[model samples]
Target chain A: MGRLLERLDKVDRRVIYILMAASVIVPLALKLDFPIPIGSGPSMDLYMAIDTLPPGSTVIISFDYDPSTKAELQPMAVALTRHLFGHGVRVIGMAMWPQGASLGQQAMAQAADSLGAEQYEDWVNLGYTVGAGVSLLRMGSSIEAVYPQDRDGVPYDSIPLMRDVRRLGDVDLAISLSAGDPGIHSWVMMAKDTYGVPVGGGCTAVSAPEFYTYLGTGQLVGLLGGLRGAADYETILRERIPGAPGGLATPGMAAQSISHLVIMGFIVIGNVAFIAGRSKRKGGAK
Target chain B: MTMEIVGIWLGALLTLALYSFLYRDNPFYKFTEHLFVGMSAGYWVIYNIYNVLIPNLWDRLVGTGDAAPDMMMIIPAVLGLFMLARLVPKGAGLSRISLAMIVGTGAGLSLVTTFRTNCLSQVEGTIIALTGAGTGQFLSNLILVVGVVCGLVYFFFSKPHRGVIGGAANTGITVLMVAFGASFGYTVMARISLLIGQVQFLLFEWLPTIPIFRGLTG
Candidate 1:
């Protein structure tokens, strides 16, 4: 028993890695999916914030993440755009991260298409703004000043969507889907605090807890933290918009939950082996 | 073969090569590592030149017919040139001016914004009324207040902790441990999600090319 516990303590790392891979791949291959329960958490708050906006109201979405976090944050972008466009809300899209510019355009385009909305009329891409928070501050006073032209070099005056959104203050709500800096924090500081605009958004799960204080402070009206948060937001969107299809976030969340349990089990077993080995050593000493 | 099929095979091979590090560092892993680093560097250089330089710097310096050239743009143009001086031995000192300007501006902006968003606003949020809040909200707020206050106390090292102060400090440590544990769990979840995404790509996307896994997934 003593030798066995010791061997378990120093189990081959490859075995653990293989098990971890199985935990993820098996659930995915089997099409294992868990239903998302509706709850009044941050994701719900974000949904309510957008849902409450009247039709024809405009919203600004800051795509502050790049390809690195697409797996985690893109679902939020697609779902949010879907919700907004489905409900007839105009969207002014922009990116603080250069890589996000194209992704933002794709999300907006897909959402608009699904809802049968026309481009440049229902939505416009402002492209990647260079000055970070400074650009956001400029947006508060005049969106036209910050982005004289759209991503395609079309002047703001020509885009029908830009007609109503002359400044950040004019928008009903601002949501930032961010992976790192110049993201939600920048939005809160430059847009919300400076212009008194309400802010909500999603971020990677790692940064979620750091933003909880902001959520509590009401600086961020709501937040969707990581893949779980994206799944939660999808749950609410499906409830509100009947027959909405499940996106990448839901399957990602299902796999993640299963892997988390597997990891937790590993932790418990590792600890038990450690305790058992220590007791055996003490007994030998006696 | 279709380009899509070729691309999938290439991606699967590269993914396997990268995952080879799990066993031990091998030639394949090193090759992928170097290729990735080289590609990323090249990609970012082109990305920045097209995204930032052409539109921001070049356009401003040599404006089109709709916008007149501003001679003032020469200042940034020169400063930007100075930034490249670091590659030369003697002219390296000249890079300090541009670097200083960048650092100074970044620091000044971050200081005010961080203070307002992270400090002042957070303080204002904690001082909410206990009366109007529902029982659940009140309890939540109470925990917040206690957690924040005790967490702050844990970091207060000005005086020696003893008696009542010691107890509060200990409680603060407990709160911090809970916060750390939660943060760690979040980090694990995030990493696991990324892993799951890759696995999904392999099993569903890459494996579908083979007949066996195609039906298995479908």
Candidate 2:
């Protein structure tokens, strides 16, 4: 028993990696799905904010993440676009991260294609601009000055959707789907606090807690954090919007649930082995 | 045959190659790593040139169409050149001017904004009335107030923790640990979510492309 405990304590790292992989793969292969409960948290808040917007209300959704974080953030971009377009809200897409331009385009394309939303009329992609926080601050004054031309090289003034949208303050609400710096933080500081524009955010789960303080201060109107946050938004959409297609994050949550359990099990085993090995060593010394 | 299929195949092969590092580092993993780095670097360089440099600097300076050349753009263009001066030994000192400008402007902007948003607003949020609230809200407010106070106490290094201060500090440590534990749990969930994404792609996206494995996807 002691030897077994020792071996368990020193189990090969590869075994854990394999277990983790299996935890994710098995559930996915089996097509397992779990019910996603919509809580009265930030996700719901975000949903309600967009849902309550009157038709023709304009909103800016900044895709501030790259492909590395696409797994976590892309669902958010798609879901936000769906909700905005469903409400007949004019959507303006932009990005702080350079790679976010194409990622945003892909997400918007997916959502737009499904909903029959037109580009440059119902929506416009402003593409990416350099200068993270500084650029955001500049947008507070003049968005057109910052992005004189849309992603397609069309003059900003020529785009019907961007005609009256002069600055960040002109928008109803600004939502930043952010992976890191110049994301939620930049929006809160530059757009919300400085410009007094209502701001919301969706961020990777790891950075979610760091932004909770802003929620308390009412700097951020709502937040969607990680896959669970995306799942929550999807749940709200599924319930609210008629014939709203299911999102990627909801199906992924089942795998997340299983993987979390696997990790918890490993933690338990590791702790038990450590305690047992420690007691055995003390007994031998005595 | 199609571009989509070719892209998926390349992505799948690369994903498998990168995952090979799980067992042990090998040539495949190294090759993928180097390819990713090289590709990312090259992509960004081109992206910046087109998205930032040409439109913002070059076009503005040289003028496009009816607009005459804006000589005022020369200030920033020269500053940018000064920034690149750090690569040469003799010109390295010139980089300080641009660096100083950046640091000064950033500090100035950040100070007022950070003070307003992070410090003042957070304090205002914490100082909310403990009364005039529902049961759940009241409890939440109380916890917030206590947590903030105790957490601050823990960081108050000037006074040595003893007696009541010690107890408060201990509670502070507990609160901090709970916060850290929650953060760590979220981090784990984030990582697991990324794994789930990759697995979904492999199973649903990559697998369905193969005739034999198509059934496995369904």
Candidate 3:
């Protein structure tokens, strides 16, 4: 039995990998729907921030993530876009990261298409600019000065989206969907602090804790942490706006909940083995 | 085959190739890895040439539309060209000027803001009002204050960790460990979320085309 215990401790890592893969795949294949309790703090704060916006108010959503983080960040982007467009709020899209521009354009199109929102009039893609936070600082004064043209090289003046929107202050709210640096941090620093515009957005779960300080200080109105956060936002959005398309995050959350349980179970088993090994060693020493 | 089906198959093949690294690093994994890196680098080059260099640098220098050519743009243009000098080993020394300007501008801009936002704001956040009415709020505030102080003390290496100071330092270390553990747990959730996303793609998005899983999706 001791020998068997010792071997269990050294079981091949490939087996663990297989188990992890199975845990994720099975829940998804079986279409498992786990009830996730949504905390009414950050998620609620973010929802109300947009919900309270008077119709016809413009919002800038900076896509500061790329394809690598699409799975985690894109759902929130899509859902947020849908929420804003559903409520007749105009969106002005921009990107801090170069690759994020395309992703933003795709999300904007999907959201607009579903609602029959007009392009250029309802929303416009300003594409990407070179400077990280510096571009944001420039935007605090003049957006046209920072981005001379839209993504297609059409002069900013020609675009109808900018007919009323001139600078960051003219917009009611700004949210940056970020995966890393030059994202939420940059928006908070330049947009909120400098321009006095309200800032909020989603980030990877890994980055959520660091931004909690910002939330505490009210520098960020609210935030969506990860897939779970995205799921919460989608749920609330669907509830508010009937017949809303169930975005990827809802099903993603189902898989996330089950996989988390599987991981927790492994952690428990691993710790038990470690404790047993330690006790046997202590007994041998005695 | 329809373009959509071909694209899906291509994506699945590449996904499998990348996942091959889990079993063992083989030629398929290497090929996909190289293809990804090479394609990314090439894409950035092409994108910047049109999106950045042409619009911002070139258009500004040549003065498109009703605007006159701005001579001031020449200085930065030359410096940017010098940035390319690093590609040639002989001209590598010339790249230092561009690098110096970039560093100088970045450091000068960030130095004050970093101090103000990260240091001052964080300090202000830590100094929460303890006189809040609710017991729950007060206790939470108390924990926040203690955690902040102890976490800071844990980093204070100047004082000798002995006696009473040692006790406080130990508590600080414990707080730090708990914070680190929470962060690690959050990171694990983030990674598992990524895995779930990939599995979802394979199972739902890719598998639907096949006859077996068609009914499952429907």
Candidate 4:
């Protein structure tokens, strides 16, 4: 038992890596799914915010993340697009990050394709605008000033959906799917505070706590935090839409839960081994 | 056989090559690392030239069919050129002008907004009425108020921490530790989510393309 404990304590880092990989891969292969509960928190509030929007209401969804955070943010973007289209809301997709433009296009395309939604009519991709906060400030006055043309080089005025949408104030709500800076902060400061447009965001889990202050201050109407947040939105969609397709984030929750448990167990074992080893050394010295 | 399949295989093989570092660093890992860095650098250069310069700078300076040329764009264009002066030893001082302008503009823009949103509004948010609140709301409000006060006390360096101040500072440390722990846990989850994403892609998307492994995936 003593030798086993010593070996476990001194286990190779590769062994831990393999365990983590197996934890993720096994659950995914088994198609394991856990129940996703919808609590009256930011995720629920975000859903309600969009759910209450009338048909034909315009909403700007900004993809402020790139492929680096695609694992967490992309599903939220796709799910949000589907929810908006399902309600007949006219969607304006934009990106704050450079690479986000293509990622946003792909997400919207996937969702739009399934719903038979027409681009430039039901939705338009504005692509990536360069300036971070400055561009956001400019957008508050005139969106056309920043994005003179859409991603495809079509003039803004030529797009039917964008004709009436002139500035940030014109939109009913703005949702930012962000991984880092020039993101939720920019939206909250410019769109929500400066322009008085209702704003919400979907961010990586690491960023969730920082944004809770915004939620408390009522600057953000709602927030979708990380994969769990995405799963919650998927749950709401599944419950409401009857036949809503499954999302990538929901399946990921099983792996997330299991991996977290494994990590916690390791933490406990590692701490125990350290304490036990320290006591044994002390006893020997005495 | 197809372009799509070829792309999938390429991506899968590259991902495996990068993951090979887990066992031990090898040629494949180094090659993939260099390839990723080189590709990203190249992609960004072209992306900036076309997405930024051509549209914003070039189009504005030289009229693009619908709009007339704006000569005022020259000022910003010059300032942007000054930013590259840092590369030259003698011209490095010229970059200071561009840096100053950026710092000045950013500070000027951020000062009012940061004060309004982060400071005043946050202070306003902290001043909640604890008396009339329900049990849950009361407890939450109390925590908020205590947390803020203790946190501020911890940062109050003017006075030496002793007695009540010491107690408050200690409480603040606990609160800060809890916050840090939560952030760390979320970070762990975020990384795990990324891993899950890669694994899912390998199993569902990439494996299905291979004939032998097709049965392994749903």
- Expressed as tens digits, the lDDT of each residue in A21-73 for candidate 4 is 98999999999989987879999899999999999999999999988899999
Winner of 1 and 4 under TM-score = 4
Comparison by lDDT, 1 against 4, better one: 4
**Clashing pairs for predicted structure model 3, backbone only:** none
Could you tell me the lDDT of residue B14 within candidate 3?
Answer: 93
Q: Give the better candidate number (3 or 4) by DockQ.
A: 4
Residue-level lDDT of model 1, residues B125-218, one tens digit each, is 8887766879998888788888888888889999778887788888899999999999999999888877876777788789889877777765
TM-score of 4: 0.98
Q: Which regions of candidate 4 are displaced past 4 Å?
A: none
| TM-scores of chain B alone in all candidate structures, in the order given | 0.94, 0.96, 0.94, 0.95
CAPRI-style quality class for the chain A–B interface of candidate 4: medium
Q: Candidate 2, residues A1-286: lDDT per residue as tens digits?
A: 8788899999999999999898888888888889887768999888888888899999998999998888899988888999888889989999999999899999888888888899998988999998878898999889988998888888878899887889888999999999998798888989999999999999999999999999898898899999999989988998988899999899998889998998999999899999999898899999
**Model 4, residue B144: displacement in angstroms?**
1.1
Share of true Cα-Cα contacts across chains kept by each model: 0.69, 0.79, 0.54, 0.61
Candidate 1 falls in which docking quality class?
medium
Clashing residue pairs for model 4: none
Model 1: per-residue Cα lDDT over A165-267, one tens digit each? 7888899999999998989989999888888999998999899999998988889999999889988988887777788988878887667878899899989
Per-residue error at B131 for model 3, in Å?
1.5
Please name the candidate that would achieve the greatest DockQ relative to the true structure: 2
Residue B125, candidate 1: alpha-carbon lDDT = 87
* Superposed model 1: Cα runs more than 4 Å off: A282-286
What is the RMSD of candidate 3? 1.6
